[model samples]
Each structure stands twice: as C-alpha cells, then as structure tokens.
Target: MNKNQPTRPDGTRDFSPEVMAKRNYILQTIRAVYQRYGFLPLETPAMENLDVLTGKYGDEGDQLIFKILNSGDFLKDLPADAVTSMGSKKMASKIAGKALRYDLTVPFARYVVMNRGTLTFPFKRYQIQPVWRGDRPQKGRYREFYQCDADVVGTDSLLCEAEIILMINEVLGKLGVQNFQVKINHRQILNGIAEAIGAMDKFSDICVGIDKLDKIGLDKVMQELADRGVSGESIAQLKPILAFEGNLQEKLTYLTTLFENSPNGQKGLADMRAITQMLNSFAQAKDFPTDLHIDFDLTLARGLSYYTGAIFEVKVEGVQVGSISGGGRYDDLTGAFGVPDLPGVGFSFGIDRLYDALEELNLFPAEATVATQILMIGFDEASFAYCLPYLYELRQAGFATELYPTVEKKIKKPMSYANNRGIPFAVLAGSDEMQVGEFSVKNMLSGEQQRVKAGELKTFFATK
Candidate 1:
C-alpha cells in the first residue's frame, strides 16, 4: 500500500458499522418513501463524457468536476499551447475528456437525450449514488457521498412541486425529524423582485448577494448589493421585499404593490400562491416533520442558474449541518440535451447530513450497534462439534450467527472477540451442557448465563 494512502481521501470517509447502521436506516426510509411516490430506480455510470457535464453547472461547478486524465502515454502528442494551459479550460478538454459526475441531474438529462427515441414521457426515477466534486472538505461537505435523489421529468405542473414537498415531509418525518423547517422560494419571485426594483437587467448580480444574506448576514449583504451597482431608489423598492413578513398571503399582498407594473412579477406571485395552497392541502404540521412556511424574501435566491421555478432548502433544529436536502424546478434542464420544454423538479437527501442529524438526536435504536445477533462460543473441542448444528439452527431461524473458526484459542479469547464486535448474545455448548439437550446462553451485556433448551432457542430470541 502507498504510504500516502490515508483512511479516507480528503473530503471523503469510511463509515464505521455504527455510522453505517444509522446511515442505512436513513437510506432505507428514503427509498421506501420515494417508491411510494411511484419513482422507479435508476443509476448512471459514476463518470460521464466531459462535454456532457461541462458548462451545465456553471463555471465554478465545471471546476468542481473531477476530470479523469487520458491514460497511457497521455503527453506524447500534446500540443505546445495545450501543454501551456495545463489545469486551464483548453487543456481540460484535450487531456481530460470525461469527469466524475458532479450531480445526478445532468447525467439524467444526457441519458434522456441519447435515448429519446425509445422512452416514455414524464419519467419519474429515484437514484441513490455517490457523486464527486472537488470542493474543500469540511464538517458537512464531502467530495464523495451518496445523494438520495428523486426527480420527475417531462412535466411543469405545480402539483409536482407540492408532491416533492410532501415527499420531503414524509421522508424526514419517518426519520424522526420533528424540529426542522423547509425554506421555500421561487426563482420567478426573485426575478420579480429584481424587475420591480428596476434591477431586472442585474437580476443575476442581485441574486448572488441575496443568496448570501444568510451566510454573511443582512448588513454585509446590503453592502455587497450596493457594490453591485444597485441604486438607492431601487434598493428602497427592494427593502420591503427584503423585509416582508406575516402569513403567505400577506407577503404576497406587499409583493403585489411592489411589482404593480411588472408582468413577470405577477406570474411569480400567482405561482407562489398556487404552490403554497397545494402544499398546505397535503402537508399539514400534524402530519409533517417541520411546519411548512412560505415567505417573501429577496434573500432566498437559490444560486443555480438552471433553477427557473420553485426552489427550497431544509434545516433541522438542533443540528449544525447545513441544508440536509434541497432542489428546485429546472424548465430547460434537458434543453442542453436537445429536449427543450421538458420541465423537471426534484430534491436530494444528503444522507451524511441526515446521519449527523440523527446522531445529534440519538434517534437510532439501541440494537443498531450490533453487526450480528449471536456469536457461537468455543468452550472445548467436543463443544465445538456439538455447537455446529445449533449454529445452523440459529442461522436457519433468521438470526445471524457465527462460529469461532479456530479451536486453538481459549474460551476467554474468543469471548473477547465477541465483546469487541459488539455481539450481544453468545451460545456456549460445553460437554456437560451438550449432553443435557440444553446450551448455556450468555447475555454479554449482563454477563448472565442461563440453560436454554435447543427447541426454545428461536423463541428466546424472538423478543430481542
């Protein structure tokens, strides 16, 4: 092994059994809920053609794509100018023509485009897979991690947004999340605000600042907006939206006045009204994890250039990890794939962040720590012979039981192995105990051993 190889690459990890148990629990729950919504499972290759991925996620995102270099004598015919631009834009295409996919959506678009002649419309699929990015590793951002995603393509129905939110509520609710909140915003609404404030042409720049409102806070965000060439009158018209509050409708009332002459603003307000109503009809606080709320804030702009419709972010209470799940509608997401007007909306459940949340809440059951239900003990040579059948019986009865492989080790030695593995129960078949048609069952947790008959072994573990 290379000395440089570490336990995990930077921005990556190796989950222990304890962590994997909790993580798998979260994933299984998400899978069940996603299937309930009728999303079929789909998976794409871990890597995709560089042309398929480049320019899809913006310049920064393109940089984050983990490009695979040309293999076997890669530099033999490289152009001098191409060699000069190593690690720059031109060289990326010449030397690295493919990349580890940054997200599932782009690849899905490419797949649909390539297979357009043979597929059905409104394809709904769920993909749970590892995606890679070159992002700086931190507490919640990992370069490689599984994103449990579900998306529906070929429809622009607001009903889909409602359903997506409903799915989010169901997944988190089943995962024992009760204090998190889902922050909802529309790209149209954000654009509307820019138009109303006479900064329509500067919508992109305005969005960059507003999206940072939470990260840098209001004061710094305002300074950033001013630096972007926003005028005092425009800023004044934007202030009320930046500070709007009350119920969903009240927020819309204020927006109506602010965007009185802006037609696009009118459409955005109408879309928000319909989406909020749809969400309310299905997602009730009594049934959902976090109470759903919609507010008018110029600062909720999602940073993606592709999000042309509704967008959202989720935060769980008492958890320090950033948005555990987030996504939005992309009307022309498949446009680059030559399938324009195929609107799609979806969300990604960041399994790692949710793992952190579950950890913070201590929601996993106590029994989740064990990798096996029973550990067969090595009492003596005769005991090992007598215990083999019992081990098979335990295995057949749906308990994961393992026998100690080496007969050379003393009983204490193997027992220590069981303890180290967190195996809770142990079966001992000593010579005397074997002849009596009963075995000693040890509760490793309590160190209490009891004589249990062979016939009753399965029954004994039923409750556990």
Candidate 2:
C-alpha cells in the first residue's frame, strides 16, 4: 500500500458534489413522500450493541455485521489458551462487544423499547441513514449503503400495509421510475408451506433456499435443498407451491386449498387476501396514477427472520437489478427488549440500488445535476468588489449564486468555471458595467447576452 496515495477502503466510495446532488435529489423525493404520509423524521446511532443486531437479520445477515472491537485492550481478559487457540469467529466474539448497525429496523426497535414511555403508540417514523454490511461488493450490492425507511408501529390494521403500498407507488412515480411491481407475501404462508411438507424443523433452511429462487432459478434451488438434506419427498411437495402461478385471486385460492391442512397457511392466505382487498379498495377510492402495479408473488420470502406478515419487495420493470426496496410486518420485534406485542410494518428504499436503476433507465431529471444557478464574474479587483453586493443580493433573492473568488483570475478561468459547474446564467460586470450600474447577463445554454440594470437583475433571472 502506498500510504501517501489517497484511497478509500474496498466496498466504499466518496461522493463528489455532483454525485451528492443527485443523491440528495433521491433522498428529498423519498422524504417528501414519507412526510406526506405523516411519518416524522428519526435518526439512530451508527453503532449498536452487538446483541441488539445479532439475531434479527437471520444467519446470513449476522455474518455480514461489521463488528467493532471492544476498545482499550479488548483481549485483556481472555485466557492465554483461548486467545491462542480460538478461530477468527470465536476470537471476534471474545474481543468485540459492539458493531456497526446492519440496518435501521433493529436499531429502531431498540429505540422504541428504550423510549416507550415518552412516545405514543402507533408511532410513525422515517429514517434515512447508512448501514454497514461486511459483504462482497458487486453490482447493486454494497458494504455501505443508505436505507430509506418508513415504519408504523403498534398497529395490526391492514390499512397500514395498504397505505405503505400507496406511498411506495407515489414515491416511485415521483422519482420517475416508470416500471416496477410491488411483490407481496406473508411469512405465515412460508411457515404453512414448511408445516405442509413436515419440515417444520427446517423452516429456516427451506426459506434460505426459497429466498434465492429468483436469483438462482428452480433447479438450483432444488439442488440446494437436496444439499441441505431436505428430503426428495418434501421437495416434491414444495415444488408446486413454489411454481404456483395465477393472478392474485387465483393464486390465493390455490394457496388456500394447498395450505388447507395447515392453519398457519390458511391464516396467512386470509391475511394476504385482506391486505390486497384493502389495496383494491384504496385504488378504487383514489385517482392513483396508472404507472404502479402490485403482484402477489408467492415465492417472495424476505430472508429476514423478524418479518411476520405482509412482506413486500419491489422490482423495477425491464431492469435485471435486484429489488429496489423491501420490508415487511414484524410482530413483537421489540419483544426481545421487553416491549412485547408492538406490531410494525414498513419498507426500505435501497437508495443506492434505486439510484442505479434510475440512472440505467435515464429517469433522473436534468435539473438534479445543476448546482449553481448563477455565477458572477469580475474582470478586475475593483469590478470584482463591485459584484459582491449583487452576488449577496441574488442569494438573498433565493437564487443559488456564486462570485468568482479573485479579480486577479483571468476571464477565461471564470467562464470556464461557470461552464464546468453548469451554471445557467453568468453575470459579467467589469469596469464598464460597474460604472454604468448595469450588468451583462450571459445565458450559458443559449449563448445569449443582455444588459440589465442592477435593480432588474433579480426580475430578469426570475422571469427566465
């Protein structure tokens, strides 16, 4: 490693101003939708106690958690034999007591438990923040990424699920994501399938394989099940359920019949039916734009162990990228912390993946990249000093304005700076314009120039 040469760690990145502008655009758009739905803003620390995060995301997610070593002689208390003989995983547990948060949901659950006395029930909150995962980085996958989450806790009403779906539709529409579908499922349905196959002990094992269905197809999923010691008989019984096909109603009817022997399955089917019916009713009542679509994907088993009912995953149309957003209902997520029976349902927009999908589809608006609206150029020291007041005035008038730093800088440099920064208009005030009390405004886009008195500068730009 060349110490002098700057480099970010692997699976991480630095966002330049342009990139940050686009990111902010995405964040603000989602934030607007979240606020419109009555979700107040929330924030939690980047790190949480290891226990709070460990069992929530299932085995794979636990392995991805970036553990933070206990500070100040982490290994001080370990026995010499243990320190010398333990493997990396065992050693890590001995030395690490905290970890970078894996996701917002767990931390939110912890927060609710700690602050339950102050907060009202059914608290709705939106959190936009980065999470760390020690996973291999690839396309649409990152070790560090922001999850835009909105969750409503303490309510079991399917209306919460319906409203979340509507918010998802409105948010994607506003972001110009034209093609996408919200795939809905229930955890109870998966449980019912496990019970039906008499593999209740292998529920997690089965879900682990089934969750990969979309990524690795049916054949591979079957082979994986076999490798995991799932009997051929169970696979045979489970295969048709995985391959079940039909419209939402038809699929539900089929599942109702298939899971008829399993009460969990029947309950899950009824829950799914209720939520979809609520969604249909909402669609009928509101004039929703025609861009959004919802589908009942029986195969969608969000791998997280906490999700209990009404799970959701969003896939962009015509894009091979993975789901852009996903979440589900969690009952008693706070129960482990002694705050039992609090039900919450929410979804997270995988901001990075969403950005990549939007970029691939050319969905970002052109204005999202423009940083400065006006750049003021000064030909000489005296003229540059003269332009400062106008720069201040323009900013006061609610325009994104900038002044050339030094009058000693050449005119070409200032023009180039403005051009490079995508400033749409340039205010050119030199000795002549300073004396005349007028400024020449150059339209960066059209190459049109016009003279305007100082008093009319704001009005001129305002009209444009």
Q: Can you list the residue pairs that collide in candidate 1? A: none
lDDT values of the candidates? 0.82, 0.87
TM-score of decoy 1:
0.93
Q: RMSD of model 2, in Å?
A: 2.4
Clashes of each: 0, 0
Q: Look at candidate 1 and tell me the lDDT of residue 116.
A: 73
**Candidate RMSDs in order:** 2.6, 2.4
Q: Which has the greatest lDDT? A: 2
TM-score of each: 0.93, 0.92
